[model samples]
Target: MDFLNYAFMQRALVSALLVGITAPAVGIYLVQRRQALMGDGIGHVAMTGVGLGFLLSTSPVWMATAVAVLGSVLMELIRWYGKTRGDIALAMLFYGGMAGGVMLINLAGGSNANLSSYLFGSLSTVSQPEMTAICVLAAFVLLVTLGLRRQLFAVSQDEEFARVTGLPVRALNLLTAVTAAVTVTVAMRVVGLLLVSALMVVPVAAAQQLSRSFTATFAIAVAIGVTVTVSGTITSYYQYVPPGATIVLLTIGAFLVLTALATPLARRRARAAAAARPAGDPAECSIPATRGATDEVGV
Candidate 1:
């Protein structure tokens, strides 16, 4: 409670809350498409932008967003055109982006220590400009994720079907990727680039264990995300721990707890389903042996 008195903590909490809401919102789509790790790839690519920002003496948040968007677009194109060798291309992109960041940051006269905060998050250090940027980015993310849910769902669940339904599959895919990249930047300060994927993915996974529908899963995941983030941020403030690591650990804890609770829920649903099933003729009927056949041939 006392920590909230400080302006820095206030900013940190606001950013953490926003990150909680937005990360899982966009992440559910990625999980639907079986591309849960795409957030990690975008995080890697955004590193170069962070470095470039430092070199150019600009805001890393916006720079990382620009660079991440381009990288995500390229990744999407590779998915389209490089189906067979896409993994290799993505590998190169991830590592190249990371290496470029290291090199550029060196050139910018900054050391690894300077990048430590961005790499692993330092919510307490967020400045007024960065806070403004985070708010704007979060608004855009919420608009895309919530406002266009049905269209994004159609594309992510089945691209070919979405195309057949005239849903602008390509545009939607690009938008999802771009939105995911922006989410990476939005969460960069709260969870750090390295751990942002966990915020994006773990809550969704946890939610899926207990949900029967996409809508339920989405709602549950957002709830779990918000729970862990706010709690973790406060814990970090008191414990003097790394906020990113603390938040990620708490998310994992929520995942495990939900997973354990899912077993009984699943069994309850199964029993209910069995009871509600319509009774009908058995597929295989047992016929009694004929009287004549019952007599053994002893000859």
Candidate 2:
């Protein structure tokens, strides 16, 4: 109730909600594909975009979005051409982006920018224009993600099989990379560059650990992402801490809890399932371990 009284807090809450929803939705794909930390690489690349924006005296959010999206596409193009290890590509992008951003910021004489705010988010720093950008950008991310769900799922589940089945695997990868870039930038608003990957990865990781079904995993991941983000934002509003770091801590905590309970949860589920089955009817009572995972992880 007290939080609702303040305009900034309201804005922060709205921004948190929007980012919370979209970031982890994209994360579900990344996690299933074992590319959960891809956001970290893209976040680094986005800083160059931020630096470029300052140099051009334009809106940093849009500039960062454009650059990050381009960087993501370039990454896909690299994969298509280089056939190098994904980790190697991300490693190069990570270092290059950091160096480029530093050089550009120095070149533009924009050192006055509060770099910490971008590295670790500050809810207080969100302006009306930035909020509007977040809204529009998040909407675009969600729409595209939802629209391309089938192709994205097929590619993530198994590009080789998808290609064999006549799906445009390369084109789908490019589209996914672009969408993931948008999501990384959106998450950057709520969690900042350093921790945005956590927001994208942790919730999905937790959900996957706990649920065998991709549907359940997706649903639970969204719930955890939204709940943790909103709670962290509210707490930060009262505590005067950085909202991004606080939200990240919440995500980390959730991930740890889920991890700790995963084995026990699996055992319990197994027991319950066993009890539900007739002693002589193993065929009727057995649940396939790969049921929902087949589509998500290509199991």
Candidate 3:
């Protein structure tokens, strides 16, 4: 209880809550779409925004938000342009953004004040204003995700099918990119630009192994994120470890344990299905079928 009384602790907790909710909510969709790396790309783009903010002596969060949004949109456009090889497009954007950010930081005389914090994360420095911004962003992200859940899910499953079915695939893809940008911006403070990808990807990855339903997977992912945030903060406070690293490590550990637990069960299910197949079934054995009115097939 006394720990809650501290301003820094309270700020950290609020930041954690906001980040945990936003990241996992957005991440479930990212993971489904196989665009998990996109989060890391946007985070790098956000560093450019932070650097610009530093150069202009303005609010880094706002700058990061704007840059992240632009970057997200650009990524979607690139993905569309490189439709057949979107992964290459994404990698190009990620590396280009990272290089641009570094250049901006260097050009700005490299003030280490907020840069390092953004690089490695510093929960101890979270301020009231930043916490408020995180809360607002989190609420907005949740609302948008919920409102577009169906469209997002459809597009994620099959964009071509969705387009053929008259769904607004382009608009949905843009909306998802925007939502991802906002999520990355909100999470940047908690995990930093360097490691924010872990926060976005790890929990969801772990949850997917344990959950069979979409809703169940989303819920478990959020739970895992929140747990990592809270536990990481506490560990950082007592053990003097870096918060971002701690959170990432905890997330990785959870993923490993969950994967280990799921593997045997998954294997058993596979074995059972294999055993259930009818013996001597030509279809099961991949044998060619005989033509109509042809001789009886002999194995």
Candidate 4:
């Protein structure tokens, strides 16, 4: 309660809430497209932006957003043209981005301790400007994710089918990638880069255990994301744990609990379905072999 007296804590809570909302909003599409790890890759690239920001003495959030967006677009292009070997190219990009960040930050005279704050999140250090940036970025993510849900859903579910249906599949894919990149930046302050993907992915996975449709999954995931983020923030404040790690652990806990609950619920549904059937004796019938046609008689 005393923590709320501080402005930083207030900002951290707000940032957590926004991160919770936007991360899953964009991530559900990635999950649907079977690209759940895209957030992690984007996070890796964002580190370069953070290092660049330190080197240039500018805002890390915006720089991370720009770099992450570029990396996501490149990844999408690789997916488009790199074919079966795209994974190799992506691997290079991921490691290269990380290495570059480490080098650039060192060049900027920033120590690993400084980098670690961004890597694992230091919620109490969130500034007013960072909060403003987070809010704006989160708004953009929500606009893209919620405003274009159907088109994105269509593309994510089946690209070829979406293309045939007259949707601009490439454009939508680029937008989704860009949106996810933005989400990575939005969450960077709350969960940090290393764990942002967990926040983006785990909530949606947890929601899926209880939902049968995309709309339900989206709603439930967002709800769960908000819940865990807020809860984790408060817990971290009291327990002196890292907010990012706390939020991610809570999300994983939610997933495990939901999975356990869903198992029995699924079995119950199966049993109910089986019990709903009308019982009757099996009808007896036999078909004559080779002589069937000739032996057939009019009733």
lDDT digits (tens) for residues 147-219 of candidate 2: 8877788889988899999998888787778888888777776788778888888898888788887778878
How close is every model to the real structure, measured as TM-score? 0.93, 0.88, 0.87, 0.92
Candidate order by TM-score, highest to lowest?
Answer: 1, 4, 2, 3
Write candidate 3's Cα lDDT for 1-299 as tens digits.
56687899889988887787778888888889998887888998888898888778777788889999999999989888978887777777777777777778778887666577888788888888888888888888999887878888889988889999899899889989998899888888888888887888889999988777888988899999999988888888888888888988999999999999999888888899878878775444555565565665778
CA lDDT of every candidate: 0.94, 0.83, 0.85, 0.93
Q: Give the per-residue Cα lDDT of candidate 2 at 135.
A: 91
Stretches > 4 Å off in candidate 2: 85-89, 276-278, 281-299
What residue pairs clash in candidate 4, if any at all?
none
lDDT for 220 in candidate 1 is: 96
Error of 4 at 139 (Å): 0.2
- Model 1 has an lDDT value of 0.94
Q: Which residue pairs clash within candidate 2?
A: none
Candidate 3: segments with Cα more than 4 A from true spot: 83-92, 267-299
Deviation of model 4 at 169, angstroms: 0.3
Residue-by-residue lDDT tens digits, candidate 4, 251-284: 9999999999999998998898777766774434
Q: How much does candidate 3 score in TM-score?
A: 0.87
